[model samples]
Target: MFSRAGSSAFRCCRALPPAVFRVSQPVQYRALSSAAADAAAAAAASPRHPARPTFFRRALSFTGGALLFTSLGLIMVLGPAYESAAAILSSPSDAESLSLFTPPDEDAQAKEDFINSHPLTLSLRSDPDFIESRPHMKIPPSWRKHNLTGGTLMGPGKVAVPPFSWSEKSGKNFVQITHVGTDLCGHMGIIHGGFLATMLDEGLARCCFPVLPFNIGMTAKLEINYKAPAMANQYLVLRATTIKVEGRKAWVEGHIETLPTEEGQEPVVLATASALYISPKQASVSIRR
Candidate 1:
């Protein structure tokens, strides 16, 4: 019975063991994981290229360079034009004839006409005679002046005499000057204020005679009252008179008149002035060449 039981147990055990069992364990995913790691490494090792510059950036650089070049070119080409425009804008209406656009011959003709109309001439050529003839007249010592020996104060076709006079009673210092012009007026036939001032200054300076010895005489005080405008190409007279003297100071008076702006038109009082002349002692130092 024991043997039989043992045999049965063995049989049972064998039978149970004999039951075929397949151990189907999950397959290890090593290959897949290795493939993934390889892909990641490959992605990390690849070099990344930088992006190209945008169109705007390249265009901006080009535009900036072009603008700089263009500005420089314009300045070089148009600088003269700009200056001419400025001059034309600021000049007086009467100055149109003197413009660059005017013909040279026309300008010369206009100038001649103006000069012929306004003639400044005196009968007496002697400065001393002129001064002495005026009774009780006081002349400044600085009046003994001379023209620049060879220098040209008179323009072309103009004549100027040296500051000299020959009269028994007249002093040795005096100057005689003359100028002629025609149509001393603008296109509208008006005498320019600048011309009047210029005439007065010339007359006064001539009356002062020698600008040497006393090279110092500033237009310290000038008061001009314009009584009338001499028509273009009219004879104008400028007479400078020295009324008083105090040390280096002097009082000078002047008048301007038109010969025939209208019939029987007495020479009008165009302008007057009072000047203070520096003394020769004070002016000598500055006058030396």
Candidate 2:
């Protein structure tokens, strides 16, 4: 039913290449597919932003750190105290050792009375040389805490009681009276010569200290002469005199003697000593002109 012109146009369209139309359609589809695949790859490769921590999580972290530091601080501060308490309470040997380091208790009135009422003490008190100076019943507390004397030698079975002393007002002379306990003996009954020497050295130094440029001195030389065996568990007397003083130097002589057991009895000399003590040059220099 087509006119001749229409039929001729139809024939021309059919003559166009079917292959060209197919190639054009496939090229468009390939471009659309590649674009969609590229978009998907880009979305996968992008970095994502992490969510922020909540308030409770941040607070918990801070609190945990604070608690750890506080615990460490407490350990640092209280460690020694805890150790001391544990040593004192838990270990018997440690407690006993600590007690040894502690100073002796102050003398009771009865003990004081015994030393105060001694004939030597009374004589010193009545003497004109010591009238201006009061009696001292004990050594310095610091000396009593010494590791050697206080811890080892000054206990119930050794020195037993605090020594009594009297110093002259002019610092020229000093006297000490004390009872040596039975246990202070190197032999079965005789007191140790070293112990006697220690007493003499300390006594002589003390006798001259007040007369020195400073009230402190070190023994530069010490000489001891043992006279007789000093029996233990007996009252003993030490008398020291400052022989000479030249600037920071002092020469002192002293002797240890047995206290007379009865009236009119001559005291037995046990040991004699002489010593030279010198104050520190620095301390002497610091003295006011």
In order of listing, the candidates' clash counts read 18, 0
Q: Kindly give the stretch of ten consecutive residues in candidate 2 with the minimal lDDT sum.
A: 131-140
Candidate 1 local distance difference test against the native: 0.48
Judged by whole-model lDDT over C-alpha atoms, candidate 2 comes out at: 0.76
Candidate 1 residue 249 C-alpha distance from true site, Å: 1.0
Among residues 3 or more apart in sequence or in different chains, the pairs in candidate 2 whose N, CA or C atoms overlap within 3 Å are none
- lDDT per residue for candidate 2 within 170-282, as digits (tens), equals 87999988778788888899999889988888788878878887677999999999999999878899999999999889999999999886879999999999999998877
Residue 59 of model 1 has an lDDT of 98
lDDT of 1 at 95: 21
**Counting only residues 3 or more apart in sequence or on different chains, how many pairs clash (N, Cα, C under 3 Å) in candidate 2?**
0
lDDT of each: 0.48, 0.76
